[model samples]
Target: MGLIFLGIGIAGTILPVLPGGPFYLVAAFCFTKSSERLDNWFKGTKVYDKYVEGFRQKRGMTRKEKIRINLIADFFIVLSLFIVDILFVQIIMVVLGLYKHYYFIKKIKTIKPGEIE
Candidate 1:
């Protein structure tokens, strides 16, 4: 299940409709809960290695990067909601999407690429 979320997250990178970072975070959390080995592997992954390092090092994301990522994510989410037109569900998704953005920002603010544990 964690791996599935990770895969979806990766796919989400290309597809504007999917949520990437949240999925990755979910995968990381699930891996930690499910298997130590998998958790280790996830931390070792090249793509996520920086995140793990940053998290351990307590380094923050560059302001520019944060703004760029937030803009892109917000744009996609709004576009998705507009196209989907799910009304109440879309509203909930908007909140969740904003929450995910906040979570990413908070994580990036605290973690630096060089700080992997």
Candidate 2:
């Protein structure tokens, strides 16, 4: 699962359609839970440095990064809204989507580029 997300995240870095940041974070979590060795190995990789390390150190993201992540998340939320028939679930997803934006904008501090390093 970690590797799968890592691959997707790597591809996301290259491809515009996929959002790499969230997937990289997920991969880091999955690796941590799976094994210490795996976690350490992932942290040592350049992918982790490029995607996750800045967020970790600065505790925020650049405006461009935030926008990209939110747009991708919104896309999936809207896609799920069409697929899921349950009104309750749909509502929850909508709330989550809104909250996600709020959290990013309000809760997480937005930093300038090159601020992370």
Candidate 3:
């Protein structure tokens, strides 16, 4: 999964249509959970430093990043809600979606690119 996300992230960096940041973040997370060596290697890369370092440090994301990540997540959640007719699952999805927005809005401090270095 980490390698898959890393591949997508690399491709996203070259492709105009795909956004790289979210995939980089997922790759970093997967690498961290899977192996210490992989996590260290990934964290040493420019991609991880550029995309995930600030978020890891609790410095938050740019407004564009927050919106893009939220929209991508919301799309999948809504798709699942439509596919699964279970009321409980749908309710959970709604709550989770709300919480995601709230967390990003309140917990993450939006900062300027200049603030990063």
Best TM-score among the predictions, by candidate number: 2
Off by over 4 Å in 1: 12-19, 22-46, 49-58, 105-107, 110-117
- Give the whole-model CA lDDT for all candidates, comma-separated: 0.70, 0.83, 0.79
Model 2, span 43-106: residue lDDT tens:
9999898779888888888899889878877877788788889999888888877877777789
The TM-score that candidate 3 achieves is 0.60
Evaluated at residue 30, the lDDT of candidate 2 is: 96
Clashing pairs in 2: none
Task: Provide the TM-score for each candidate, comma-separated.
Answer: 0.54, 0.65, 0.60
Best by lDDT: 2
| Tens-digit lDDT track of model 3 for 1-117 | 999999998885654335566788899889999999999999999878777896777557778888877787777778878888999978887887787788778877887766744
Off by more than 4 A, model 3:
1-39, 44-51, 56-58
Error of 2 at 62 (Å): 0.3
Residue pairs in collision within model 3 = none
Ordering by TM-score: 2, 3, 1
